[model samples]
Target: MAEITTHQLVKEFPGGVRAVDGLDLTIADGEFFALLGPSGCGKTTLLRTIAGLEAATKGRLTIGDRDVTELPPGKRDVAMVFQDYALFPHMSVADNISYPLKIQRVPKSSRHATAAETADGLALHGLIDRRPGQLSGGQQQRVALARAVASNPTVFLFDEPLSNLDARLRLEARTFLKRLQRDLGVTTVFVTHDQAEALALADRIAIMKEGRIQQIGSPREVFARPANTFVASFVGSTPMNLHTATVSGEHVKVAGSSVPIPPSARSRVSDGDEVIWGARPEYLRWSTEPVEDSIEGSATIVENLGAAALVTVDAGGTLIQLVVDEDDEPEMGARGWVVPRIDRTLLFDGASGELILDDTPTSP
Candidate 1:
């Protein structure tokens, strides 16, 4: 129900460790936004800072329209769900859900009634009297969400809430969480290291690293056009294949092949320049026969992925991966050609590791 905005937000530790460094961001009202990065990448700290659990070292934080930079967690009107689905071990499900309302001094009758209604909505009405120890992991997670919903806060913050669930249950809970957020329409910020989780759940994602944001975009935009090498190497199920190559005319020499510069990077490249060329496995063509501008290599390894397989080929000491139908998976050591898609290929500056996405090159 509220948009969250931060201007020059900073959270630093006593030892000069800057967990979140002068980051500026805005999450739209009722938007599902995610903070994605590797472990120890300040995502949790950032989430905690927004929740008022960790005070900000500098800058401003506003929820909806109020400047809440100096407010306590209780006064911020935000609900947070931690990775472990922190529930009261001794309290019954209904009691746990109604605890926040009780702290607000709501009448016992009214708070219980509200808790019952929220529990029913999350399919936990039947187990309202069960303690946390009696519930399954998935049930505990729902109880945590029910507790947050009972408060009806303007914003929701989640710190890897699905990490405790088993894989199958995680998938189910993911769908459930998405639907829950859509139905309630609360502005939510989720922090996680899982790329798939971020991709599947977020309306927009802020990709972070070392306490700084690297890119912000929709799922498809980040996947198709990564802002830089770090994002290109991190956003996909199988990270994009990135390799160093020397520019020769309009082509880059790599993997024992001369691949044309991608349309997006053509005007940014020149002869004798060293660049990092990249392509996702999903975008490359698989062939047993030789073709134009194709990488020639022998299949070194094949990884089965349900209906498809990731084929790793050794091309003149450089490894290139391509996804092929399970039926078309090549035998080990089979010779083949994997062609990088001309239009979809990516180029990054060799020294800067910055994506060369525009006409103006980054080199001298």
Candidate 2:
């Protein structure tokens, strides 16, 4: 296994566009890490650079204490599985999985034996003779993964490998991939624009934007304590409710209603300084009447998601979403209340998108 590191990595293209700028990463041996961000944010560029497919304009890469910055992809001891699976329609599953071993000139008998074992382990034994054209999308992806693992490379790289599958297949593939990583203990680095995929599979994730890393931490750390507003908003579904407001004495006014700001929140800001407030839908509740830490609004939409319903309310002018039990869903166009759980709220500096210091109050 290899621990990969990059220092001050830079990548430039024609027309002087810098796709990746001063990026640094440290991935431990046998750890599953992910690079997550939206498209054009330099995620794929960074991954390709690590794979040696694209040369870095500047910086150094080391794998297990060896400097490999200048090595070619084949010589770097890394195998990459792409979004398209990159399988040949003409080759059977067994042939494709054995190709990596053949390239390294492994004994013919040994390669065939290893291929059969890998196919059985991946539950693809019965489909070994089938070509990519004859298999379903999920089955084809498994073949691609089986091929990468058969290489026995120290590092396994995935670039949106499940993007082509449907929702159900994607979930199943996610489980398969996670289990495979743990079972093989391969040092893996996967890149995905989907936040949920990152949260689900990664041991730790590095969230990126505009060619720079926003934050790197475990999924729970990133979600519970977002480094900034962008991360808080990007990581969750239904989006966090953000409201701008002024602080005066112990009161904060929203839509001309003076709601008492909790003591914990008051200590974070000075008098008259603006702050952005955030709360996830799950931490909010609906009520029949306006109350403390609450906003009155008209129900705009109600979406049933099996066991729970997502309620969208138009509060004066702000649209707030609330996650509630199925029994509590309000009818659309009905008057409702928005009660926020202050303890679960997040505060950010409006100008810099940075998180502000807050002393969370203890619940009685």
Candidate 3:
């Protein structure tokens, strides 16, 4: 296992468009870290640079204690799993998994033994003789992952390995991948655009935007206390509802209504500072009674998902969403009120969009 580090990493393309810019990261040995962002955000480029598939225009990369910034892909102790599975259709599962060892010219006996062990570990033993075209998508993906690990590389780089699978298959694949990584204890760097996948699998996530990392933290940290508006809006489903507010003493006035600011945000807000109030969907409770932390509104839309319901309430001009018990969904055009779990709400500086107390933890 190895710790991977990158300092001032940068990648520029032919049109002078910078794909990755001034990135600095350190992945502890045996840690599962993820680079998450939208498309065209440079995560893929950074991964390619680390893998030695794409040279960095400016930066230094080190695996464990060795500097590999100038090394070729073959020389780096890293393995990559791509989205396409990339298996040869003509090759059997055993042949596919053993391909890397074959390329390095391992002794035939040792290669076969290692391949069998990996296949068993990945639950691919029964399908070893099947060709890539004959296996299911999940099985094919497992073959790709198994092959990548058969090399025993120090670092495992995953480039959206579950992107092609169906929703249910993705979940299953995620569990398998996480279990495999946990058992192997290999340092891993996963790249994905799916916020849910990143939150569910990564030990720590680096949220990227426009070629730069906006925030890096545990899934809980980024979800409960986002670094900025961009992260707040992007990290969760039904993005944080943002509203302009003015701070006065320990109170913030939003939409002409006064809401007491929690003590956690006290030191971060000045008396006259303009602030933005944000509440996540899960924190907002819909009810007919007036309550502390409650705001009045009219129900505009309701989506009753089997387990829970996502209700949208039009609070004056702002659309506030509440994820409530499925049976409690209010009818459209009904007058209602929303009570936000104060401890779960977020506050940001209006002008900068940065969290008021980014370094501090908030109650979940």
Candidate 1 least-lDDT 10 residues: 355-364
Winner by TM-score:
1
Model 2: colliding residue pairs? none
lDDT of 3 at 8: 95
Taking all chains together, each candidate's TM-score versus the true structure is: 0.97, 0.94, 0.96
Best lDDT goes to which candidate?
1
Clashing pairs in 1: none
Evaluation by TM-score, superior candidate among 1 and 3: 1
The TM-score of predicted model 1 comes to 0.97
Model 2: runs farther than 4 Å from truth? 255-266, 358-364
Write down the worst ten-residue block by lDDT for model 3: 355-364
Candidate 3 residues 195-280, lDDT tens each? 99999999999999989999999999899888999999999967788888889887887765667775567777889889999888
Rate residue 323 of model 3 by lDDT.
93
lDDT of each: 0.92, 0.85, 0.88
Give the local distance difference test score of model 1.
0.92
